[model samples]
Target chain A: MPKIVDHDQRRSEIVEAFLSVVARKGLPAATSRAIAAELGVGTGALWHYFDGFDAVTAAAYKRVTERTNERIAGASTGLRGLAAVDAMMHEILPLAKETLDEAQVVVGFWGRLAANETLSAAEADVSDMWGGRLRDHLHEAVDDGDLASGTPVDGIVDLLLSISVGQQVHAVMATPLLDPARQLALIEQCLSPWRRTPRQPGETVTR
Target chain B: MPKIVDHDQRRSEIVEAFLSVVARKGLPAATSRAIAAELGVGTGALWHYFDGFDAVTAAAYKRVTERTNERIAGASTGLRGLAAVDAMMHEILPLAKETLDEAQVVVGFWGRLAANETLSAAEADVSDMWGGRLRDHLHEAVDDGDLASGTPVDGIVDLLLSISVGQQVHAVMATPLLDPARQLALIEQCLSPWRRTPRQPGETVTR
Candidate 1:
């Protein structure tokens, strides 16, 4: 009998190859032939798992998105206030090499998806999902009286999401603010102004 | 004498065409042929002013960087503190349609430039130039005692730049924080925590 291959695992491996090439090279270099060559597989082999380049690209992006969400969600477990949000933001920012490479791929994919509707929808869905998490966290803060009552939960949610995305760009561009330690401090400072009480001299907000 | 076209003006026009193509289509689509077609000029006309595609792209990117710097300089004439930073950040973020388009192009170009030494150096120069202005403003804030004394100017500068770039990505992804107005408010709130004043009625420091 022929050995059974885990379709999900195989698909994930292909996606990883897709992401690596796209991140190292720009989106254009992430062509089907290039991906196949990178993977040392026949060009037709990719189609066996994915519909085509678009499908593969979409899947690769989805793979990144899912992994990111999972990490953020895990970090956010039982956390509240700015700590939870910061945790989520840190998870999204491009600091670690893997996350940084993932961010490059994500931005490139966003550009490529702009003109392609299917990819655009997938992009939108992922963004919306992330936004929803941010919104939920903001709402939670509001409920706990950590945030001001009149502050628009929706707006704050958006603000956090925007800052998170901006941080990724900063990271890839090697902008001064891309320093992980500084980013953490600034994020903490940024959240400070919105809090009801001044952060005590030594209180770890996360605790 | 044969009619002499203003070479600089002609190049500027070509740069504008390149920007349009880059903003509308991805950079890959902004080939010399496409730009010439957009300008209603023969394909050879571009080569008359530029060495080739890379020259046009670099020039176009420089044009954008100049335009953005001009806007920030224009907007923040005599502004200070949170207000100065606000204007600078707003100018960089994808607030309006024109800036939004520029953000997309800038981001795309930066990614492509990452691996190319010449391109990356040029891009880094633009970023440093921008950061210098920011550092100057920050130093001014510190001098005025508007910001806390112990604050790290370089760190803050990085944070500010990071937030702006992150915001651009946020806007492009259609995250909730699309509105510049709300984002500005959040930024103001974020900066408040770092101010020397203690426990203002509305302020809460959630460390």
Candidate 2:
């Protein structure tokens, strides 16, 4: 009988090898040869599944986004209101070595995204998905009465994402100032105004 | 008489050339030859002030930081408290095309920093300087009764810096969702709780 070949599994294995190469030696050095060496295979093996280095890198990026989405979904499952938001935010924070590695890879991609349109679109897609999920939770909070009516969900979501991305950079750089606990506290503080009674007359409504 | 060449000015010119090259081409493409061509000079002309490509890039990075610091200082020269913070934050936001270029270059450097310790330290130094200035403004706000006495200025500064860095990325990526005005409003919103009157017992204190 012919040997069974799971194409999807093979592609995933190649992506994992790409990620390991990236993690060990930044994105610039993660050439086809390095990735192949990572997988204990010849460079030609990668081309069997990918067109070239770019194709493999793109696949690895997709894997990163999918894995992140899965984690966010798992954390936010069966939770609601601020609790759900908190869970989702925590899922993105680099609190552990594994998550830190993920954050490092994502941050590394920012520079390439600046010059590479293909990678930029891929990144934007992931960002949009994350933003959408966060927006849904903010709407849920409003519906649950945890957030006051007229809360600017869009702006709040933007602020939340900005803070999270910034924290990821600090975490990878090992900035001593913003640890996991402090990061959580900052997020909570940003959310506090919305939890208050509806904006009073003459108060500034941040949109 | 021999022609007079100002070493400091020459170095500055070379740095500018390096930046222009980087802006036009991505970092990887901004080779010594490219920079020299940008200056309308031979590649050896750069050797007068710097050792090689690495030296030129390092000098360019320093120039970026110094220019950013100078702008922040100029903006916050006579301002204080939340106003000072606002001015400083505004200086970093990509409200103008020039500032947008600066943000683009900074974002581009992040990928290199991920793999290069030298670049990473330079970035951290600039961040520390920026954070320290922000902390000073927050302290002033507390001293002036703009913020409650027990406010966590350190954490607030961290949050502010994080938001600013995140905004830089968005500004570079042309994340259409956050225009300059909206970015400023978001910063103000993040700082709003501190601007509120001191909380009494049973009141929520966000810091």
Candidate 3:
């Protein structure tokens, strides 16, 4: 009988090797030979699973995005308004060592995006999906009377996304300032304006 | 007289060449040969001013940081409190094509920081400088009654720094959701809390 080959498993192994290579060494050193060596295989073996280095990168990126989406979706289920947003934000932050490595890989990919249109497109798609989900939660918040009727959902989503990306960079860089508690506090402050009751005329909010 | 070269000016030129090479071809192609070719000089000339490719990169990074600090200081001079913070943030953002290149170079440097301790230390120093400046301004805001008492200055500074770095990544990537106007508006919202007057008891301020 012929041996069974699980193509999906092999592809996943190749992508795992690609990410490990990228995480341990910056993307510049993540050559096909290096990735294959990481997996204890010959360089030619990578080509069997991926069209080329670019294919491998794209696949690895897809895997990262899928994992992120899965985590966010799982965390935010049955949640709405500020609570849902908080859950999603917490899920995306680099609080764990493994997630920190993921953040580093994501940062590595940012440098390549300027020169690689395909990778850039993939990243943009993931970004949009993330932003769209947040926007949906914001809309739900407003509809549920958790946010003001005229709350700028679009702007809030943009702010949250910007803060999230920025926090990822700081966390990966190990900046002394942004510990997990501080990070969570910052997110709360960004959301605070939307959480307040609709103001009466001439009432001051900030002291 | 033998040809006299101003060492400082020559160093600047080499650093410029390094940055140009990085901006045009990403960090992977920023070898001594590529930088020398960019400057219309032999690779040996780069060795004359810098010890090696690492030294050249370090010098280039120093130049970038100096340029950034100068710009922020110049822009924020005579401004105070939240105004000062706003000016500094605006100065740091990638508002022009040149700044956009700086952002790309910055993202490139971030990837290298993980593997290069010298570069990483240099980056941490710059981040501290930037954060310190922002913190000083936040302190001023509190002292001047521009913000509420117990306004969490440290957290605010961390958030601002994170948001600024994050926005730089977004702007460089040309994320459609965050244009210049939107970016500025988001910053304004982050500042809005401090801009408002303190709320009286039992008063809603969101109107």
Instruction: Write candidate 2's Cα lDDT for B24-107 as tens digits.
Output: 665556678887888899989889888665456567767877887798888777788877887788777777766676766676
Candidate 1 per-residue lDDT, tens place, B115-179, comes to 23355455646556767888887777778887887766775565556666666555555655666
lDDT of each residue in B1-207, candidate 3, tens digit only = 133457777888888987887667665567778878888999898777787765665666577778887888787778888778877777777776667667766765664554354566655466688888889988898899878777767766777777778876786567864477777777666766665474354542221
Model 3 gets an lDDT of 0.72
Candidate 1 chain A weakest lDDT stretch, 10 residues: A111-120
In model 3, the clashing pairs are A199-B206, A199-B207, A206-B197, A206-B198, A207-B148, A207-B198
Candidate 1 Cα errors over 4 Å, as ranges: A1-13, A20-31, A44-55, A78-83, A114-118, A138-156, A194-207, B1-11, B21-31, B41-55, B78-83, B114-118, B138-156, B192-207
lDDT of every model, 2 decimals: 0.68, 0.72, 0.72
In order of the candidates, what TM-score does chain B achieve?
Answer: 0.77, 0.78, 0.78
TM-score of chain A of 3: 0.78
Worst 10 residues of 2 chain A by lDDT: A198-207
DockQ of 2: 0.38
lDDT score of residue A55 within candidate 3? 71
Stretches of candidate 3 exceeding 4 Å from the true structure = A1-9, A20-34, A48-55, A115-118, A148-150, A197-207, B1-9, B20-34, B47-55, B115-118, B148-150, B197-207
What's every prediction's RMSD, in angstroms?
5.9, 7.1, 6.9
Clashes of 3: 6
Across all candidates, the chain A TM-score values are 0.77, 0.78, 0.78
DockQ winner: 2
Give TM-scores for every candidate, taking all chains together and pairing residue i with residue i. 0.75, 0.82, 0.81
CAPRI-wise, candidate 3 is acceptable
